[model samples]
Target: WTEHADKKGRVFYWNPASRHSSWQHPLTPSHKALVAAYRRIMQEEDRLAAIQSELEAFQQQVEEEVKGWRQSHAPDGTPYFYKIGTQNTRWDNPRDELMAHMDLRMKMLQELSQMPSLLEEVAPPADVTGLDRTQDSAGLSEAAALTDGPGSPVAP
Candidate 1:
């Protein structure tokens, strides 16, 4: 920051990098305000760090609690999780919905793999154009068979 004088000869501070001009000197009460603001920012950073530490500790506690659940398979080959300490048991797997979706996708893929790659449904007959068509007994070309009359009335 540098000091400059306006056309009227009044002392003004100018910051070339920020293109800012101030009538007050830099070392005045603005220095105290800057120091107070710096203190506030440091306090906020410390508070956020404390909050993050608490969240991490809470996450660790949850992970440790989840580790107590034991997985076992039923006689019919179905899986379940049991937490003996908490007397909690569930027949359905926690990831059952996602696994069921993946199972359906796999089944569809297997069925598609068994089909012929070039398989196609039956196509309609080729259209008979005006060329190489003999006039019918009604004196109408084969291409004129598209008439709205009954039974097409082409007479073969």
Candidate 2:
């Protein structure tokens, strides 16, 4: 990194590797780590913002899907909704179903968020000298142990 002053005499730090400038001083290795961390933070923030935007758009689409719907009751006091000028009728609120779907999607999103950590845990280490500890003599599974099948299974 190199330091310079702006026209107003305000000091800043520049990184030749990243070609980025910041007002904060990057004087040490820790500061460089901070810069990398800050970049990661910014990327995560942007990712969250995009997810939020998509969620908002999804909600808006749901609202539009149920626009002009009027709530009413059935003869047995069961609630329902009917469109303003159409033959469409629903026995349940559209939002209720959509919200339930969104809940499932959010759960999937949470699981997806942890996938990288799971992958990291299962990945091979850079140093392979100790990998033999997990290997068998043939480095393979027996026919009876191949998914507990007597023979290899064909691909679907």
User: Which candidate has the highest lDDT of all?
Assistant: 2
> TM-scores for all candidates?
0.29, 0.36
Global lDDT scores for all candidate models: 0.53, 0.56
Best prediction by TM-score: 2
- What's the distance in Å from true for residue 129, model 2? 18
Give one digit per residue, the lDDT tens place, for model 1 in 102-132: 3443343344334543123336656554234
As a whole number from 0 to 100, the lDDT of residue 82 in candidate 2 is: 82
| Candidate 2 residue lDDT tens string, 26-80 | 5343335334533443356354444445445545765786676888998999887
Candidate 1, backbone clash total: 0
Q: Determine the C-alpha RMSD for candidate 2 after optimal superposition of all C-alphas.
A: 22.5
